[model samples]
Target: GWTYGLNGELRKATRISGIEDFSINVFRRDFGLVPIKVATWGPFVLLNMDNEILQKDNIDTDNVASEWLGSSSELFSLNGVDTTLTYVCRREYIIECNWKVFCDNYLDGGYHVPFAHKGLASGLSLDSYTTSIFEKVSIQSAEGGSKEKEDDRLGSKAFYAFIYPNFMINRYGPWMDTNLAIPLGPRKCLVVFDYFLEASFKDDKAFIERSLADSEKVQMEDIRLCEGVQKGIESPAYSTGRYAPNVEKAMHHFHCLLYDNLIN
Candidate 1:
């Protein structure tokens, strides 16, 4: 489309065949300016031109075909689904410490799962939990965590998976997956919790929505407590804190990894 410069001089056209290089050059010569941006989204080539020329030449799509009436142009064609799928979420909160402190707490479930996540820990006995580590990845799973229980109504399992550089996938039976602790700044972060459902439940919109709502509520709870921890870490008297041998393993694991990387 033309803006208000040399109006009626810049025009657009559609053809049954593509335009040849020579014909394009000839048209550009008459118009006196080449296109700034030639954008194709789906089957459409949207053209933008200077405004003043378009007004002066009384140029529109029809004007272009009449002026360049030749056999050099062909139809516009495009393929299907020239697009990609993406998902993103954003949140902002006030935090009051060096961001790494928060990260340390999240990386290891060995420490705080017993303390910070008391309710979560209760459902899956911490005594039976085991940690498995890989390069930049670790998961804490209960001894029988993967097995479905005979009385598994609330569907509880305790396992935490850490994907390095600030994302955790916490699994709780067939119900939940928490995409945890994404940093927003040196002291702030955002977390997302996504829940999974059985294939049979895929068509159940109500069930899926309920699961998501529950997941979100739990995430908010985690954020509230984590933000509080951030404040405590900011105290001038606090430099470093000791981890509980059982409860803070995740925190320690995370801190040591970070320390090793930072120092190296």
Candidate 2:
């Protein structure tokens, strides 16, 4: 059974059999009657049903953006520059690596950018690259390089933000894309990419196609690096390695947070 109402008016009740608990409310019926917490920021929607997270105090979705993003919260505000963007395309990539391995590769600042992603590195000022870590977030930013053109793929600035576990939001030039990593097995994962472009550019078919192709090329480069790293980890002779203090701070932060969650 379920009830619907608008502003406490035009109320209606629908009855259904086998529903033993009406008090158990959740946002998705597919998950049964378990309680689900939802929060929205601009065009982003976050849903959580983990009891471990729900048990914590002050879990309000409204405060999540501010708390996790800190000073960067303004970038996602409804009245901000993001408002000019509209969803354009989505892509999925199946990678032969653990979910955490993908995250580690992303959080390694820009250490591997120059060596493994030559095309991508050419558009960014690696010397000026910076990484900032917060309680539950890490941000890496860089300025366009000297060779960047007026209509460059990455524009004049780039920001890559990682939200804890397995989510990433990348904003570069006039484009924005989100990456959601889902684990399929011990060494397999799926990464979903949703791209958005400035509303004004949505009608430019050639531009959109060129942008997507460039993005796919970079992703393919990353996939090779991640898969190789996973294979190395599985080697019997593989032992613990040291992190590059200046470049791998965010990766270290991720490992620490993952350890805390697993042990607790």
Candidate 3:
């Protein structure tokens, strides 16, 4: 079961003339529900702004805008309106997987893409891997299977990119951007996926369907494999795992960072 709440009546009381006023009231109210899980995904909340009713009046759509735009709560009054406003809380829950493990597997692509996801990476032929690191971040790219030339022929082929801390940018022929393995808990995670593409990709519905199917297959593979690995990690049989030279460098880098932070 999933849940959320929006005290519309409460929102109306805090109404002020501008965003600044709304921020003082609506944005500050401490809603009681503690978030056990959260993920950076689209539509966490959406407020329709720049619309007719809103634009005609000198209304400060800030309170509503803030909530949709990253404001944690709703506590403002409409700028030009005199009546009370209310909101409906929205939320949904699905599946069983922990946060940390999901993050680890998501960040560490070395284990599965080549093996479990042969369907997707088969052509990529990733024998070894390499990484680029920053002060507190790193980006890992898999070694070859398909030639860069072939990718060009495909018009826009797929490639994997990992942005440290918890962001993944998967470029599937200029059509997809999915943030896989966002932590929801120590054992649960949320995979956020979005699709975009060149006009060519969109024109081919069959290709679009095939691509989406392939993506789903790869994701399902990841979920199953990560879950199994999680079970194995709890078994006492394995206390730690080693990185295969540069093959698993991302994982090693992650572990080193974790150690540096926790131990310091």
Candidate 4:
């Protein structure tokens, strides 16, 4: 594919295969630009421009979402059926905070769920949640709470994956979504949530509405908490905080990645 640029130059476009879970093709004038990785996972397409700092990562097959694209995939099977999922909805949440703060809140993995997100906490059993830290990826999973019992569509569990830097994939029953945490400035960021749903539920208006309502509530809570943290960090009285070894391993792992990239 090709398109005329602002200056009337014919820009060339091509697809970069096998990097992302999906197919990604972009138009650019020359090869000087970074490589774009397209990852299509569970009905959503993720487009990423490879960061030179972390391009050398050796990701595990289990942790890579693209592996699920295979006909023989097992991790994200829908009721034992191996098939591709369908696209659904998407929304973005803008936050007045450093991108790290939003992600840090995500990686905290403890304490905040019960206290900060009361409504969302009802749907999740914090006691059942567990986090597994990997080389460049992390997985957090938990069994459903009361909400699961009410919704027959959702299975008995949910899992979330965090790819290094700023990408997140969340899977709940037959629904999946990815969060691209794009940092706009030092204290501003945009968290784009692209939702993918099982094609079977495409016409279920009530189900979709209920699901989105619940998700929006949780997102609002996160925005409030993260925005507050960003403002709090500017306080002269507060410098740094401690991390609980068992509960906060993910946050530590994320920080280490940032430090390594900034230094070397």
Q: How many residue pairs clash in each candidate at the backbone level?
A: 39, 0, 18, 6
Local distance difference test values of all predictions, in order: 0.50, 0.81, 0.49, 0.71
Expressed as tens digits, the lDDT of each residue in 29-103 for candidate 3 is 542343222222232222344446333433344443343323312211111111221111122223256655655
Choose the strongest candidate by lDDT: 2
Better of 2 and 3 by TM-score: 2
The residue pairs that clash in candidate 4, if any, are 20-38, 20-39, 21-39, 21-40, 22-39, 22-40
Look at candidate 1 and tell me the lDDT of residue 43.
Answer: 20
Give lDDT tens digits, candidate 1, residues 1-264.
Answer: 432234333344446236565354454456555434334432224354656553554335544422221221111011011122111223343444345655665655545556555544545665776665555556666633334432131254445666555665544434434354556677765554444444455676675566555555545555666677777777787787566765556566676778898999
Residue 75 in model 2: lDDT: 54
Which residue pairs overlap in candidate 2's backbone? none
- The stretch of ten residues in a row with the least summed lDDT in candidate 1 is 72-81
Global lDDT of model 1:
0.50
Model 4 per-residue lDDT at 257 = 85
Q: What overall lDDT, based on C-alpha atoms, would model 2 receive against the true structure?
A: 0.81
> Looking at model 2, how many pairs of residues clash?
0
Candidate 3 residues lying further than 4 Å off, grouped into runs, are: 1-95, 142-158, 260-264
